[model samples]
Target: SAVISQKPSRDICQRGTSLTIQCQVDSQVTMMFWYRQQPGQSLTLIATANQGSEATYESGFVIDKFPISRPNLTFSTLTVSNMSPEDSSIYLCSVEIGLHYGYTFGSGTRLTVV
Candidate 1:
């Protein structure tokens, strides 16, 4: 099991501003993923962070917008660049221990853009 922590539990930003959220894990995980949950919507996978390599982003996400950094095995960060009100959502960092263990999610960083 891994315990994940995220910073800035909630934030309100003006349009065109950006925020960077930090994710820390207690133990090294094989797969670290980032997700976004819009209001009343399901969680959408943003990217998968692989150690010693560039992050693999899912569809509808680009590196220029949501840049991810995995400096080491147990730490990662996501920067939401060029923010817009449409981008407001709960961004969560998650990790899967195994197929049976399912995924564990961070409390999430609730971002609101005005």
Candidate 2:
């Protein structure tokens, strides 16, 4: 199993600004994913990060708005760009530990855009 550390547990930001969230895994992983959970809602898949290649984003999520970087097998980052009040949500990072072990998720970064 792999342990993940996500930065800036929570933040309050201006509507027009951007924020970058970082996810670091203790062990190397082949599949890492980013998700966003709105208030009182289910988790939504934002993107998938594979080492040495560009991230693949889900519908309604674009590279320009939610840029991702997977520099290696153990680290990745997600940036919420040109943020708006509607963008306020809980951002999380997850990794598939294995088929048997299931998945592990970060503590989550709560962003509130005013």
Report every candidate's CA lDDT. 0.92, 0.95
Candidate 2: residue pairs that collide: none
Question: Which lDDT tens digits does candidate 2 get at residues 38-103?
Answer: 999999999999999899999999999999999999999999999999999999999998799878
TM-score quality measure for candidate 2: 0.97
Tens-digit per-residue lDDT, 1-114, candidate 1: 679998879999988878999989999886799999999999999999988899999999999999999989898999999899999999999998867978999999999999
- Top lDDT: which candidate number? 2
TM-score on alpha carbons, each prediction? 0.96, 0.97
The regions of model 1 sitting more than 4 angstroms off are none
